[model samples]
Target: MCSRDLKTPWIDLNTLMRGQRRVLLRHGERPYQLSITRRGRLILTAADQDTDTAAAAAPPGKARS
Candidate 1:
């Protein structure tokens, strides 16, 4: 299993990735992508790959009042 040091402010991407192709992050209903580049750089992006599905699955109560 992967472990993280909560007391530290940094995240070890290598450990986080764990040989995975990509990592998906979900905030409420929105999804984000984290990936690595060929040049050994980290990339973060808003994963809009499934906008329709996300919108359909989103809870209505999460909307602004």
Candidate 2:
């Protein structure tokens, strides 16, 4: 199984396909979004507790189609 640092949230790249909306996981009672770009890059985002700008997790894999 893939494991991640508990210090940060993890989003699976394969799960984020273009034009989808779903909750991948939760952090401290808040949900995060997993999505893909038209270019097929996977994305992970969480609301920054200190600001409106979303805090993004690192992409999980090497850029691949």
Candidate 3:
């Protein structure tokens, strides 16, 4: 016989961020950056800080398809 009743700890999203810009930083030979805007939009910036990687990676010409 086996039991499946288990309790997990709760994690708060705000607590994780702690009121700061949350950016995903890739570290390696070819590093990159990604983040969620205050308006709740996904953003990607290159090292040059002029190109939007997310926009470029987006499906041809669709918001999210």
In model 1, the runs with Cα more than 4 Å from the true position are 1-8, 49-65
> By TM-score, who's the top model here?
1
Candidate 1 lDDT by residue in tens digits, 1-65: 26776876776777877665466677888787666666667677686756443342333223312
- What range of 10 consecutive residues in model 3 has the weakest lDDT sum? 56-65
In terms of lDDT, the poorest run of 10 residues in model 2 is 51-60
User: Which pairs of residues collide in model 1?
Assistant: none
Q: Which candidate, 1 or 2, has the higher TM-score?
A: 1
Query: Can you write out model 2's per-residue Cα lDDT over 1-65, one digit (the tens) per residue?
Result: 36666877665544443334322445777766555555765466763344221223334432312
Error of 2 at 42 (Å): 0.9
* Winning model by lDDT: 1
CA error at residue 52 for candidate 2, angstroms: 17
Task: Tell me the lDDT of model 1 at 44.
Answer: 75
Candidate 2 residue 27 Cα shift, in angstroms, is 2.7
Compared with the true structure, model 2 gives a TM-score of: 0.34
Per-candidate local distance difference test? 0.59, 0.46, 0.48
Error of 3 at 61 (Å): 25
